[model samples]
Target chain A: MTGWVAVAGLGPGDAALITPEVTAALADATDVVGYIPYVARVAPRPGLRLHASDNRVEIDRARHALALAAAGGRVVVVSSGDPGVFAMASALFEALEGVPAPHDLDIRILPGITAMLAAAARAGAPLGHDFCAINLSDNLKPWVLIETRLRAAVRADFAMAFYNPRSASRPEGFARVLDLLRADCGPDRLITFARAVTTPEERIITLPLSEARPDMADMRTVVLVGNSATRRVGRWVYTPRSA
Target chain B: MTGWVAVAGLGPGDAALITPEVTAALADATDVVGYIPYVARVAPRPGLRLHASDNRVEIDRARHALALAAAGGRVVVVSSGDPGVFAMASALFEALEGVPAPHDLDIRILPGITAMLAAAARAGAPLGHDFCAINLSDNLKPWVLIETRLRAAVRADFAMAFYNPRSASRPEGFARVLDLLRADCGPDRLITFARAVTTPEERIITLPLSEARPDMADMRTVVLVGNSATRRVGRWVYTPRSA
Candidate 1:
């Protein structure tokens, strides 16, 4: 039998948040490959061999896992949050496209709780309506593309969920995005900042885009920008029902 | 000790999708209360008493769960998706507001994977930008309010995720919502129909708003309307990014 690979989302650093399908996939896998932090999340299951690696070597790790699968082993590749959302699943597919492998392997992506969804739920439905998720890293894609997408989402009146909005190297990128959003989406749009969602140190703050301070956000933060229809009722922020 | 009640989201029919905090809460709970369908999803554990009820008696079930918690039992009220998204969590809070209980019970909401998120993931990145979730039932709120919200979401250029879009008793509601969206969002907006998300029979279809027929959707279907900025790249649909 030809080997198969399943890319499973473990969810935001929680074992219980792993889906039943993901659990079954892990249980049936003879080998597992993932980033070190994500690999440690899975407790030792019988007959499960783990290949842990640093975060930087994604293509190499995916290639190794696919090779194991092509060798007739049931291998599972794990990622935190949803595998398709800036996780290893896309990289796996991208890598597979480039290589001419000997055997045909089935690639399946099992969805899990993304950080944006978790953060939105934690912050009381900031994402109750339309929204967008943008990565500000500008590492793989050009900054111009990010800027274009951001402007388009704002003009389209979408609630915005920003991932990797800011880092030590890209500190000004988030602020720049916010500035553009404020210009196009108006400064009064509600913005919810969620940090370390689902963890003990989780912090959530609901504010307006006009009042959002750059100091409050970081690489760990997931910033949610409310749509034009979003409203502030007392201390809670929500996107009102569409009419 | 004054008993505490925690409302938890179990995610969409998958046990592993339950968060770690929710799992810990359930593990520590003396009693678990939910509809039979939701209650059956979790594994049986020692010292955990279960109180399952029929589907229609949600408010009564929530009241009972709160009463049990008031009687000094560590209780957990469970909902299958996110607790706050048209689920029993709001009812629990509403019931609590009327109780006039002397003891202060800590009510914590642990987030889970809502069905909209699951459906969106299965259907590609249709929700990569702004969107809304509307319920077509109008069983509690007036249809006027639902219509108003729909228009507002569309005017705001939100991609929309509709819930309870159709039922045996209210079959025309989804069509009405589609009409309103088409009127405000125009005919070319992309619409993704997702059914039985994350299940064995999951089906996803992507089309334009003008092409989405009422016959294609039902109560189980989550209708995603792409925003004005949405574009189709071959088979994938996504909202263009704004900065």
Candidate 2:
């Protein structure tokens, strides 16, 4: 069999949300590689090898997949949400940069439903207008850069979705974010915290920016902040299609 | 039977890209309403009704779906990509604003693989970092607003994905966009034009901002402009996760 690499997205924690394209990639893989939880999502098969690794080791995992594929293994790297969105696809390409003969390999990136969109769907159409998706984690980039993007998004009057809002290691960042949002957007703007979206533990809450707390968001949560014109129609919150 | 309305996304343009959750909604729907081409994608069945309308009639289409669902008909309003992203979900809520008793009806927004994400996967992960999604069409908003968002996005150094980039009625808007991008992003910045993504007629081209022309994109294209760190490895283009 010809060896190749397929970077596939498992979507945001729902089997029904996984696209047929990604499902096919997983089924055809000789080896599956990813973070431990993502690798656990794939079922054990007769001929498939699963390589589960820890977090913050994206480059290492990516290099392992590339090396395996180069040695004639059909490899699939799994990412929880869309792989291209702050996930393994970019890391795979970054690893490919050091490959001796990268041009000879075949690779494909399969898209899936991302967490922000899934959270938006559950909380009505808060992102129906122009939007910005920012990763709030400061592990890879500076916190000042995050502040810059947040202020720019607010100035642009765009709806915003934040990924990796808070983690156990960094609980203070989200508090700072809430403070910034309350100061800039005022108290009336709508904000939704959707945790473990589409899963059994799913919980979604919409409140004013002033009432939002830092503890509402964790690593599994996606936070959506509406634009100036967003409002509630009956029980659902949505941004108008028009400005 | 109880009535309901589901604003569902058909994805960019592939059967495999449509999630099973959306498929289940369509299977249960008694009526399907959407723009001409999207409605045509659904197969006619014995008990199903398809309502195909023309462009620029979003509010009317939304009201019709709402009325049908209110009267005990299961309705599915379809959109090309994710329904909540410049699509039918927001329009449905806007129409619900004028309903006599909107809370009595059941409504759900089913997400899908959006065009930008699909296109990003196709051309590697050019949107792997922070990004802004802007609708270039000035039909609902003013040109000045679009320009402001463009400038803010540039200042933030966020990658950008543009929807509805150009149309026959307003080709000059995209020309202005190209000029603005050329000035702000400089000559070496990368831009990818992905037209008819995931479809048989799909065409993708990546080039420097200096070489990009307005004619390269149309209504069917989703234009992606990479951040300063975006680069090519072999034949693939990707934006690194770190800023």
Candidate 3:
């Protein structure tokens, strides 16, 4: 039998949000590998191996999956959201760069519903216009570049969604981000904080930039800053289709 | 029966990419409304009334869905990708601004896999880092604004995805866009053209900005311009995680 490797996205927290494509991949997999929580999401069955690693070991996980594939194992590497977006697919390819696999090895990347899109949906389309998605964490990139991108996105009048806004280790980063947004977008601009979205613990709130506190966001929060044209209609906020 | 309105995303083009959440919404729907192609993706059943309309009539279609829901009919308004991203969810909220519906009516936005993420997954994660999504069409917004956003995105050094890159009526727009990109992004920058992604007709190609032409894209194309750090590994193109 031929062996293969497929990297799939599991979508946001809701099982209902998972696509049939991803489900099928999991069903056919002989091994599932990912971060601890993500790997735990998959149901364990007989004759299946689950390899859950710690965070920041993405490259190691990718190498392991590749090695499994080389040994004639059907492997599925999973991520919470689309593996391509700040997730595992790129790390997989980065690992592939250093290794030489057979030309016929089957490798596929499956798409999933990303967190930014899921958060925007719950907030009634604050991202209806052109938008930018930025990961606020400085672990992978420099803080200077994050600031530069934020200013540029603001100058373009694009709505923005921010991932990893506030983590326990980097609580001050989100505070700096709020200050930058206030300086550029002004106090009256609207921003939404969607925490644990699509889950039972989900909580969503929209407030003016001046009223936004950095404490409202955590590791699980996805923050959205609207464009100059975004506004509220009754209980919802949305940017008009036209700028 | 109680009435509800769900603006669901069908993913890029594949049935497997559609979420079980969205599929469940359709199964419970009495009326499905959307553009002709998107509406056709849903299966026809005995109790379902499919209302497919022409393109550029999003407002009218949204109004019809609202009316159907107001009359106690379960309605599903579908869009190709996530409804929150340049799709029907905002249009429904826009229509809601002009009407007085009962506060008890059920309205939900179910997210889906969007084109950019799907395209990014297929092309190896050119959007793995910070990125912006812009619609190149000038149908609703001014061309000047589009140019301004393009310049802003380029200056920010953010990866970019362009929707509706070229059309039969506006052949020169994408050409002008290519010229602006070449001038700002430099000739060696990498760009990926992903057409009909996730579908059997899918085709992806990557090239330098200097070698890219307006004719390489069409209405079905989603063009991705990589960040300054984007490069090729073997047969794939991807942006590195760090800056």
Candidate 4:
């Protein structure tokens, strides 16, 4: 059997949000590998093996998928959102750097609806204008870099989306971010906290920066900070096209 | 009949990239309205009507959809990519702002794969770090604002994706942008030009900033500029997770 690997995105939470391209990849796979939560999203079926690992073991999971593919297995490395965006696609390429494998591996990266876009859709287009998406987890990069990006984004007046905003191990990072944002964006700027977007447990709140508390966001929440011209129309918050 | 409106994304170009949520919305819609190209993507049905208009008439299209929904017609406003990202979702809210209609209309914003992410996945993940998406068109926003944001984004070391890079009306804009980016980010930086992404005629090219010409990007293309740490890994171009 000719072996191949596909790094596919499952989209954010909802099955309906998943594209047919990813659905087809999942259907064609002999083995699916990803984080525990992401792997559980694939349906249980005969002749297909599911290998789910923990969060911090992304490199190991990428290697496992690559190894299985090299051994004549049709593998799909699943990511919760678009694999290219702070997800498995980059890690897969990173894995390739260490392996002295042939250049011609049949690998494909399928895109999906990311958390920030889903969150933007649920909350009325706070990312309607120019925007930046920043992963708030400091495990990969330094906190100083995060602060610099945040301040620069605010100064540029672009809307911002944040993923992995807070974790149990480093809950204080989001607090410092909030403090920094408050100072940079001032009190009246709008901020949106969307938890579990597109799922049954989804909760969305839009408030001014002055009233934003760090506790409003968690691991499951994606936060959106509006640009200077973003505002409320009726009940929805949106950034105007002219901005 | 009870009416509802859904601003849905059709993904970049391929029908396989469209989400089930958007497909369902199109099936349930009695009237589908959008730009000529986007409206043409929707299949015609027995009772369904398609309203394809010229570009730059987003507000008029938004008003038409709102009026149809107010008169109990199920309307789906189609945007080529994600509806909320430089697309129709914000225009709908802008229309709502002008009219004092009932606060709660059954309006929904469905997300899809934006061109940048689709292009990013097709090429490797140049957006593995924090990134910004800016529309290069100066029609909506000032050129000065674009220049300021470009400088800020580069200084922040964020990977950047540019939409609507060049148009017939202002073909010189992208050349200026290239000049500015080269000055700020330097010529050794990597840039990817992905045109007609996910379509049959798709073409993606990656080269150093020194070689990127103005004509390389047109209205159909999405341009990605990698961060300082972004480099070529084998045949793929990816930004490392650590950066």
Top DockQ prediction, candidate number? 2
lDDT per residue for candidate 4 within A1-243, as digits (tens), equals 888999999999999999999999989999999999999999989999999999999888888988999999999999988999889998998888887853768889999899999999988989999999999999999999999999999999999999999999999999999999898889999999999988899999999999999999999999999999999987789999989
Error of 4 at B216 (Å): 0.2
Off by over 4 Å in 2: none
**Model 3 chain B lDDT-worst window of ten:** B98-107
Q: Using Cα atoms with residue i matched to residue i, what is each candidate's TM-score against the true structure?
A: 0.72, 0.99, 0.98, 0.99
DockQ of 2: 0.91
Model 3 CA deviation exceeding 4 Å by range: A102-104
lDDT by residue (B156-192, candidate 4, tens digit) is 9999999999988999999999999899889999999
Could you say which candidate leads in lDDT? Answer: 2
Once fitted onto the true fold, the runs of candidate 4 whose alpha carbons sit more than 4 angstroms away are none
Listed per model in order, the count of residue pairs whose N, CA or C atoms clash below 3 Å is 27, 0, 0, 0
- Higher-scoring candidate on TM-score, 1 or 4: 4
Please state every model's RMSD to the true fold in angstroms.
Answer: 5.6, 0.8, 1.2, 0.9
A26-58 per-residue lDDT for model 2 (tens digits): 888999999999999999999999999999999
Ranking by lDDT: 2, 4, 3, 1
Pairs clashing within candidate 4: none
lDDT of 3 by residue, A89-195 (tens): 88888888888653456888888888888888888899998999999999988899899899999999999999889888989989999999999899999999999
DockQ of 3: 0.78
| Whole-model alpha-carbon lDDT for candidate 4 | 0.93
